[model samples]
Target: MTSVPRRTLNEAVTRFWSLAAPAYDFSALQRWAYRPPQDEVITLLRDHKCRRIVDVACGTGILADRIQRELKTEQVYGVDMSDGMLRQAMARSGDVQWLRAPAEKLPFDDGALDAVVTTSAFHFFDQAAALREFRRVLEPGGIAAVATLAPHQPPLLSRFIDSSRSLAHNPAPDEMRALFTDAGFEVADQHRVRRPLWTRMFTDRITVGVRSA
Candidate 1:
């Protein structure tokens, strides 16, 4: 079977989100399905006391906006590959420096941020390259919190699920921790999180790692 070209796959994802940006915030998936995981990410970042933070693949800037409000800091930034998404994000907040950039290539300087976060979108990233960039842009001892889907049980079934998506890949929980470790971060915490009384439609494994100091 022929594989989809990398560029083609990326462009498709961008186009899809660009079109989805207009009503993304109002989507049930965003309002209901993903709320629990997003909340968990917010709590983790707050607990770490991150003052300077960036949210990657921050569609419509919902999470970034919340972070800015929670931290009461003006150093928050939101980045997404979709221009349409950034436009929507810009309307949401003036404090966050909204930028259009891919996960593998951030606009921040080395050791510039206290925390790097990307929730509900890690499966769409080139995990290795993105993690490396996350580490590169974070100060030593900074936190990297990534919340996303993971492959389910049964080794062969997990492999099948990952292979089913040509443009997206969901790593197993252990594999995600290993990826963070390989990217020069110390695996700090890794677990599945869900809001109480919420449907299990989108439970995500959140992995927190600290850049080696």
Candidate 2:
């Protein structure tokens, strides 16, 4: 499939996060801003058997901390494009390895990871490029659990995001899944769970997939 224009998407993301960095922590506009439910999501990750997990687009290390607490893994790494966000994440949790990088380009060796998880940040990716990167870094049979809030559900969050002069765009699940398939992952499960309005903007669905051997 043809890819979206890189320069356009990069510029949009850069501007969006750059302006968002200062007030981002206090912004209720992010899909899920609360803490407890995020712990529940981490519990789900712990149930999986894989070790050596990588959290892509791991903004503020919400999921990373949970991984460190719940899972007995050899390594837990977090990667994001925004340095300011990474700084906040690093400050919050010093145990996990935080890297400043885009999801589309990972620095790890091929087939280095056992599992990959992301929460509420999939839509920002250039889907195809990010998935290809996931496929490249993930070992065969490695699982990827990606979570994103639905665009149609949360009116308040939607309104706030729409009002944000910097946020360029957001995509639906179908569009996101298509990119996953295009990158050669076989989707194994898709689940939707309702979260409190104060906790998150809308209900979140977690999609799990595996790279074929």
Best by TM-score: 1
**165: Cα error in model 2, Å:** 9.2
Q: After best superposition, candidate 2 residue 50: deviation in angstroms?
A: 2.2
Choose the strongest candidate by lDDT: 1
Candidate 2 C-alpha lDDT tens digits along 86-193: 878888887899998888898799999988878767766766778888989999988877776665656666664433542423446676577678887998877665
| Model 1 agreement with the true structure over 18-56: per-residue lDDT tens digits | 998887887676767567777987888878888999999
| Candidate 2 wrong stretches, greater than 4 Å | 1-4, 26-37, 159-171, 197-201
Candidate 1's displacement at residue 180, Å, is 0.5
Error of 1 at 124 (Å): 0.7
**TM-score on alpha carbons, each prediction:** 0.90, 0.80
Error of 1 at 134 (Å): 0.4
TM-score of 2: 0.80
